[model samples]
Target: MTVALMWEARAVPGRAAELLAWTEERARELTERPLRRETFRAPQDRVLVITWWDAPYDADLPELPEPADDLTARPVHRWRFESLGSV
Candidate 1:
């Protein structure tokens, strides 16, 4: 089963760009690479990341951590999903 992990964070005012860069750097240093990875930005200073893995949900993987207190207005949020085959 393929697992998709979504990570999201809301940056403080005027810090979206920095936060995005931080996440990008962290992604590069992951101990275990994902099958695929992508990132997106929202209009209101939010950043989103999606990482796909061939391992099951319970497998251990390097996860994105929260940005420093000064960088984000709130803590990061994460969710996991399992892919379903087409009908």
Candidate 2:
């Protein structure tokens, strides 16, 4: 099975760049390499990171951590999904 972990955060008014850098650094520092990892940006200064792993849906996997409170406008959001295969 393949599992994709999603980590999303919205940065404070002017800290989007810093948040992105922090997220990228943390993703790079993950001890275990995933099948694939990608980062994205969206409106409202939100940053999203997705890491795909070849493991069970409930398996433990490395994930990005929340940034400093001052850097984020709200608590980070995360979700885990089991891939259903591409069309």
Candidate 3:
């Protein structure tokens, strides 16, 4: 079954752009895996990262590269989803 993972974080003021750029580059490198789709969004002070995977696997996806010191607060929220047919 296809699965989707959502990662979200709050960027410190002007750090959203930098975090998005870094995540984009890192996400591209994961194309060789089950990754089917990926995108990043910056709304207000929050950055959202969404990725779709073809199937559940134990492989670890690429991590976002380091951002500027103090660019964002530590810890991020993540959610995983499994497609349950069309709603």
TM-score of each: 0.94, 0.97, 0.70
For model 2, the stretches where C-alpha displacement exceeds 4 angstroms are: none
lDDT of 2: 0.95
Global fold similarity of model 2 (TM-score): 0.97
- For each candidate, the alpha-carbon lDDT, in order, equals 0.92, 0.95, 0.67
The order of the candidates by lDDT, greatest first, is 2, 1, 3
As for TM-score, the candidate ahead, 2 or 3, is 2
Q: Tens digits of per-residue lDDT for model 3 on 47-75?
A: 77777677664435544454555766656
On TM-score, the candidate that comes out on top is 2
- The sequence of per-residue lDDT tens digits that candidate 2 reaches over residues 1-87 is 999999999999888999999999999999899999999999899999999999999998988887999999999999999999999
State model 3's lDDT: 0.67
Question: On residues 1-87, what C-alpha lDDT tens digit does candidate 1 reach at each position?
Answer: 999999999999899999999999999988999999999999879999999999877888788988899999998999998889547
RMSD of 3: 2.8
Please tell me which model should have the higher lDDT, number 2 or number 3.
2
Candidate 3: residue 63 lDDT (0-100): 45
